[model samples]
Target: MMGVVLVAGALQHARVHAQAAGFPDFTTIVEKAEPAVVNIRTTAKVSARSGPQGQDPYEMFRHFFGPDFQPPGGRQGPQQNPRNNKPRAEPEERSVPRGVGSGFFISEDGYLLTNHHVVEGATDIFVTLTDSREFKAKVIGSDKRTDVALLKVEAKGMAFLPIGSAKLLKKGQWVMAIGSPFGLESTVTSGIVSALGRETGDYLPFIQTDVAVNPGNSGGPLLNLKGEVVGINAQIVSRSGGFMGISLAIPIEEAMSVVDQLRASGSVVRGRIGVQIGEVSKDVAQAIGLPKAEGALVGGVEPDAPADKAGVLPGDVITKFGDKPITRWSDLPRLVGETKPGTTSTLEVWRKGKPLTLKVTVAELKADKTAAVEPTPPKVVETVTTVLGMEIVPVKEDVQKKLRIKGGVQVTAVQAPASTAGVAEGDIILAVNDTDITSPTQFVKVVAGLDQARPVGLMVRTGEQTRWVAVRTEK
Candidate 1:
């Protein structure tokens, strides 16, 4: 009887312990994490609508109603309301609220993180903490490609959450988010990580979750049970402008790297090898002798670029960069973009049904390196070749002078990919992949030299404005 009682007691204790271990209580986490979360508000400048072209109210009334329409007060402006005997208010212009988002302190000195879109073009920014303390914040820098932004508030000894790695996170792991959803400050929501390495952006492998993130939660922190921030809540997959179980967050590792860059130089600089890459289709993979479909398919290598100089050829599928696996085409971009320029990275490539290793010194993207300048005309035109299904012709001197452009190519005809890419007649090609088009022949050669399996960026000038169009090519 004594042995039976002892056994029953031990079993009950074990059951209680199992229950405690299986479900973690987030009360402690909430207490520690809530103080670090902040609500962000921004304002933008806007011009007010002009009342009427003419100052005279009677003239404006006559122009709108009729030639002989009478004014309300007999040739005067709006009259007083008869019921209240009060003058009516006129519409006035002012700066208005632009956006609302959430952010969290990353350092005790008040450095914070948020989404770039939340603060882009904002004229004024304000942040509010859990204790109802508000501070005007400055935008340190923003990287649009990664959708990450850094901000600094004028405060010291601020509460901050410890950073954790999203790489350590697993699917079905419990996580929580603290944010301001639709302006509800200090709101908390919990869920399990739905997935990781989600290909949502070319430069980010997002951490997907089912947390009830909404509009104002754009820049909040996604925390683990330990109260450490693993990701920055960013995007939501929704059709009705509300959270419908799918939310995405930027991994903390990537966010921290971007924050460091933004803090140092007001902008993020990313490494580029100047090769256009596509996905390795199953058929292509099989044809190339791979056991399974994987890796980034190199389609176009820009002339004189780092990849071209490093012997990275067209049709070579990149299996790995440095030691990171390129399981998806998008993974290559994120890896390359995170790497520092001038770093000699080893690339494992699959070519001719065999593996080849190549060394590529990464180069900084031109847009991030220097401010854009107008191109000077070249004295001569190069040989002609065709790609992207566009007939190229040298721009007439008269047309070039009239358009204020030194040199360009005029599109004579569009077919196949060009037609589908919205290229039209009379559209002047200003540049190809950031290289200034000196002449029609040069433009043709540039296009022809491009691999047909890649997308070509064409700077098309239509009328007085110019825009970039990525022309798709047949793979």
Candidate 2:
């Protein structure tokens, strides 16, 4: 009887040890980090009588159509009642919940960090801690480009998470998130770092994780195994407006940089070199005598801009920005944007089958728009020209002078093909299929000669941005 009891005790002990070895306990980390996590709620005043029917536009369509009806490209359509033309009665004004998100305290004196989108345009901001303490928060500063905002509350002696280095984060390492997902306060989820340096946004290279981050998890803390904050839970790639096993967090290093700027100033100032760039295609790389398909291929250069002044031409492929390599096209934007304005930086580019370095003085990125200049025209001229559902006119001398451009064609009207291709009025046509459009006649002629079966690429300058648009020819 004693031997049998001893064997049973040993078996039970072995089972307990095996369970401990298989599943690591996370209760200690959660208990330590939950106090710093916060739930944020915002209120905004929205116009009760908006749109043609004097009813909530989104509600009218959604409620009437059973909530599944969506227009092309997910844009809301006109909410007009065919049978009833009279305006529906609605309240004059009301305050509604604008958004719900999560944040974390960064200092003991009540300084916190959250996503800028969480409190953007909110009339009232309220923050609640894990200990049931609530306070109204003041928005110190927010940077929309980085999607980071610094906030301050009136409370004191708050719990804060220690900052960890995101640069040293590796894949397949354990990580956890603490947030109020779906209004569930202090929800803790654990997962491994799926990947790092994910390019999902224009400015940030996000830290990708498998943590179950949901809608209300935005602006929360992504903690390491040591209870240190590694990143800020920002965005998740989902189709159903819920977590789909892929979540992205803004790296702590990038967030701290923005936080420092916000603490010092009300806005962020980033450097820019006036040039439109795209990824170097494999075919283009081979054609241009490149060793491999890499770097940012300059598509267009703004006149009198930093890149233009530094002799950075359109055909130059930027291989390196300063000491950092441009392995992908997205790397150039992040590197250049992080630099300060008026700072001179060296750019190493591949040009004409050789590597060349150019020194460029960075310019402060502003809200101003850059106009397109006329390129050198083709030698041959074709007689038969079609407008392709568009009416255009050559840029006048005064307009060209105001736009700071030599010459280009301006769009006056748009029809089916042009409208379907997103060609709106007030757009300027710079080039068509590698041929520079010097006049409206040349644009029409180029469109007429384009192959109807293949797509036609047009370099369009719309307001402040320039990009290539592929328009399908009319059947």
Candidate 3:
């Protein structure tokens, strides 16, 4: 009987130990994280009537004869003077109150950090501290692309969190989040960093985690184990409209970089290389004599742009830009966008069969606003028939004028190649075997000289739109 009791006691002890090991005490972390997390209350004066056009006809009648209606001048209505009659209280003007979002304190002198969507178009922004004190805030600056904003309050000596380098973060690292989620103030949750360098869209590169992020946690901090701010909880991926273990946070490094720029200037400025590129595929790798299909393959270089001026040709493959490794095509845009214009940088590119180094001055990228044009006549190469019924020749000047292209190949005619591939005449050819074609001669050389059977990419400019089309060669 004594032996049985000892075994049961041991089992109970082990269960208790397991429970204790599973849960971590977040008291200190929460205490440190709470001061930085703030509740954002914004008020916008929405015109009661959506203008004179949307006014309800019945509203005018109700305003005239309602029980609380008052004639413009001072007047008193008949009052019932019964045994327990009391004077009716005056009706007050109705107001609409709205509550939303959260933010964090970033400076001791009352500067706060939050998402642009939080206070955008807000007429009045009120910030509530962890101690329940409130202050009015003003917008200092905002970057819509990064969704980051800087705000200023009238208070000083406020508690703020120090920024930490997100570059050092790695997957599986423990992270803590503090914010007002679901109107619950100072809610704290903990989880591990699920991934790093996550690109949700081409514009947003976020830190992925498993933290429980909800509605009001939009601009809250994702704290590292050392009590430093590593990322800003921004978005989540879920089907049930709630946290299903997938959350995305803006890396503190990128956020801070934008914040610093916004604080310095009213708008953010990004560097441009003036080249359109795509990922290098396995077939392109073998054709280019590369050991692996990594790096960005240049598709087209804008005329007279920094890339063109620096002699960055269409057939060159960019392996590295400055000190950052261009492992994939998507990495180039983000890295270049983060750099400032006029900055001179070194580019490591694979030209022909040898690695070449080129120095380039970054240029300002302008928004694409030009309309597309139709393809021009081909320069007349020995017309080759692919499995597709189209007849393709080299691009010509008349084709360039018809296509409105500064440089590229034109589709001369459509025969079996067109019917089989569904490509019609007037489709300009931009790239073949990942090699860009600027002139008819280059296009002919690239397509006819290729020895492998691989799909070719074409940038088709039709009407007012441009689209990427991939066409396979004859087997």
Candidate 4:
């Protein structure tokens, strides 16, 4: 009888636990959010570059058909098509279907949002509503960096979704996604937030979820339990070219920012500080006396740019830009890009075991492409001295002046610990640990005094990039 009582008690506890883990009912959320969602179809004009009679025009239209297929009219000169008067050789540009995606209206005036790739290169865009009403849409603008586009339709009284904050999202919170996955319009999928602020690129940190997103779901709305749109479904991680339980969304806040800019100027302008940044490793942090591995390590600084003028340098770690703390290397770019140009912002950098603050005037980004590496080193050698298994020599005066360095020793040869640490020939050693080496003789003395048991930090510059390499003195 006691065993039977215990079994009943265990089953009771299990039932209570199940009750606490309440499963969500998504039918209500779908009913409210589905009307705002839209199905997007695009068409592009592609040239059907076959011959006049669809024959192979091999070798400039002479090698095929025994060289008798002369012109568009055979025995006569070039003639126009009877139906359209367009040259027969010039194959008529056809409006072929390009792709299908999803979107959502943001306002009642018919301004909608979708992915930039959806309408990219598209000649015609059409948006279909839940009521089966379709209207032609004109792209207001598109920003490829954020992959967001703004489109406008002639319709009025369209249903729009209320925007929500992704910052307030937490893990395990129920979220819903409405998109046209695989051309299935108004399809609804539900899942909990897998993660937030997931860094997948240098520009935007994505909101990662397990929602069922596929190719046709590129630009749909991701909503919270409040029936507010939180994100735009943008990407997925899969091997079979389909959903694999991982979908990424562009946070609605970020997408709206791009939309505002696109609506105002038909383009998005971003700020540039003119520095190439990289990750700060733990070893580098320890060697530089940083308390923790955080912030962006400056690898290269463009001359005469904002960062250069603000006294930023290679090997310095940027801890903060204005009021925003740079927690990772990729965080800096997004923060800088978001800042308005011509505004003076506060900058904080870690230099030589201390934090230095400076004011920088943010400049408008001229181009989106990365700057090429500069400063081609001159081949000149003088008084080679061997230290740390590296043959070092003073850089020539003209080369130093051209490179704009006050003093540094050029490494001509390397082996063992130095080689293992990635120091290479033609590399310029600018500093040993915390001290700048003024000459080849001084560099040799600095290396001789380094603790053999501990790895020493050497600031080495290769081409336009600078980094700290840690090498133990003993083999």
Candidate 5:
């Protein structure tokens, strides 16, 4: 009976252990990450007018009661002095503004990281430590594009967290966040990584998680299970402008790169390929005769760009850059931004159903360069109504000159065939019925060759590039 009791006790102990393993004890992680997180407060001095020349109340009252203060023009009141009425030396009002944010310590020597938006235009910055000690902070550098800022405080022996590799993070991995939200200091939250390579349309790809991030959580650290910061809490997506279980954190790998660049040069210099790329959809894949839609499809190449100089053309699918696989379309930017300019990198692309390799010398990205413009629009001539249910006009020289194009057809009015095929008024038709058209005669002939009820492919140039649009001919 004693032996049976021992067996039962062992089973009970095992069950208890399993239950404990299911949940992580985040107390230690919070304790370690909290000290590095700080509250940033900024104050701006506003100009105020010196108090109104010390108004003499006794003299003003006596003046109002004087006999000369008799009712002015039958009005039962003293006539106001024009000098005193001249706005009473309007007190100058200047706004003294204040703001708050959060930051994490990156170095023991007092280097800290926060968002550039937090410190931009700030006149005075004060950092409050976890222990409630405050110190004035100085901005070391700030990168507006990445929104990363480096700050320094005059304190020694400060606790800092080591940066973790975001590349090693996987979906569903546990993470924690410590930040100041709504002026509350050292608030800790936990959640699992929900997704990766999330594009928030801000050009910075982020790691998506379900962490409970709030307004004041920006620039806080997202800690991994090992107590290292793997990401920087940056933004959240919600209709109500608050956390709705969706949060985005800048990957530490990218954030640290920006931080290092800021520390070195007070700004970041990103490498440029000078090509516009779009994701290869299933339809595009089928059109391009690709086995699968897996790579970034080049839609346009900037003139004189590194990609252009390397003979990278539209319709080429970029499969790899250097040693890294171009798994997603968004991955290219992060990789390119991290690479130094003037570096030679190998690019693998698929062109015309065959793999091609090219060596490209990355160029320094010019901030103010304008994107490439497409071919000019064709002029409108005799309007011809087509079975596509649209009125097409012949190319005129004036229209081409106005559009600054060498050749193409100008879309005047789009109806069934054109509108249904996604053609718009400003679109310049470059090809119709698979025949290149530079004039109205050629355009009409190409359309005449198309069979009714069959799909006709038309290449239309819009904005900066040309895209193929398929429209069904009228029966």
Candidate 6:
């Protein structure tokens, strides 16, 4: 009985140990990480807004950002200037404090990182250190697409945080943030890494955390327990413009890649392959004989583009670009954007239940080439075939020549599963599964052979866009 009591006590002690491990002590991390974080203040010359009776017009703005808030572009003029009693030439320009934000040093030689929006449109930038040292900062470069900007100050021997890879981060891991929320310098907030690789931006994936990041927290360092910088707090999801549990950080790895380019050319250039893509649906996957719903669905391919020159078609699914697997449609742009322009890369394309290898030369990302398809021919073929709960007719000869199509059936009416699959009246059906629909009689014959047990692939053309739609005739 004495032995049993001892064992019970041992189990109780082990439980207590496990519970204590769950709550981490952040004092050590705060002490080591706080020195590297800095408060950023900006000023700009802009037209000011004032009331008729010299009353303050931006009292609400001052309430949030303190009395130092300087509105970037205030109402220039309608009020007459006191000097001339007429609208002042080019409006009255006054230098006032623009905004307040936070940033952190990444090197001892005074290289720092912050959000592009933080320093955007600021005529002057000031960096303040924890030791009360202040210096004028120069904007090295800023990329609006990724929301990353690099700034440099004249200093050496500065305390900086070690950069860590955000790719190594996992959900539910302990993380901390040190920033000036509401201009409160060196404020510390702790939370877990809520998620990773969140697709909030087109070119960069964000690291979402539950850290209490607020207005002034933008461009601050998000540190791991090792006091390493994993991400830069850039945005928050809140209705009241305050912290509401969801904050987004730009991953340090991607930011460093941008920094490398910014340090070189003061700008960023990305590569592109001209293909408009969409997510592959489960029904479409099964209909196309794919094992699972993955890869990017090619909905439209621009004429004479890289993908078109590589034989990428509208219905083909791009499984891989070079050696990188396209886990989703968003991954393709990032991979392609990272590749050098004019460099040839291998492409793995899935078409009609078979895989094909092709090569494509990437081009510089420029203006979008995904223009809308030309208008359909108003005239419809006289011959009509009614089948599959809809009326089908051949495409007009003039329409075929204009659209450069060999043959397709125009959808005159749609009902039931045909409409259920997003097929509408006036849409054009170009194929049934793998067979191209050329004539009404051919379309009728192809519709008769459908398995009916599973979803069927329908190549549909809407407006100028063409894509594959999955339709199940049987319930």
Which number leads on TM-score? Answer: 6
Candidate 1 local lDDT, 161-253, one digit each (tens)? 899989999999999999987689999999999999898544578999998887778889999988999999888776543468998999999
Candidate 6, residues 103-214: lDDT per residue as tens digits? 9998999999998888887889998988888989999999877788999999898888899989899999989998887678999998999988887545568899998887
Candidate 2 lDDT trough over 10 residues, lowest sum: 56-65
For model 5, residues 348-432, the per-residue Cα lDDT tens digits are: 9876557899999998886834566654434445665453555566556765675445666667677886688788765777655
What C-alpha lDDT does candidate 2 achieve relative to the native structure? 0.77
The global Cα lDDT (0 to 1) of model 4 is 0.82
TM-score of each predicted structure versus truth: 0.66, 0.69, 0.72, 0.81, 0.75, 0.83
- Span of ten consecutive residues with least summed lDDT in model 1: 52-61
Of the pair 4 and 6, which is ahead by TM-score? 6
Q: How far is candidate 1 from the true structure (C-alpha RMSD, Å)?
A: 13.3
Number of the candidate with higher lDDT, 5 or 6: 6
Which parts of model 1 have CA positions greater than 4 angstroms off?
Answer: 1-21, 50-93, 368-475
What's model 5's lDDT at 54?
Answer: 25
Q: List the residue pairs that clash in candidate 2.
A: none
The whole-model C-alpha lDDT of candidate 6 against the native structure comes to 0.81
The local distance difference test score of model 3 is: 0.70
Residue 325 alpha-carbon offset, candidate 1, angstroms: 3.0
At residue 219, candidate 4 shows an lDDT of 87
Worst 10 residues of 3 by lDDT: 55-64
Residue runs of model 6 more than 4 Å from their true location after superposition: 1-21, 48-86, 239-241, 368-390
Show the colliding residue pairs in model 3.
376-399, 388-416, 388-417, 389-415, 389-416, 389-417, 389-418, 390-416, 390-417, 390-418
Better of 2 and 6 by lDDT: 6
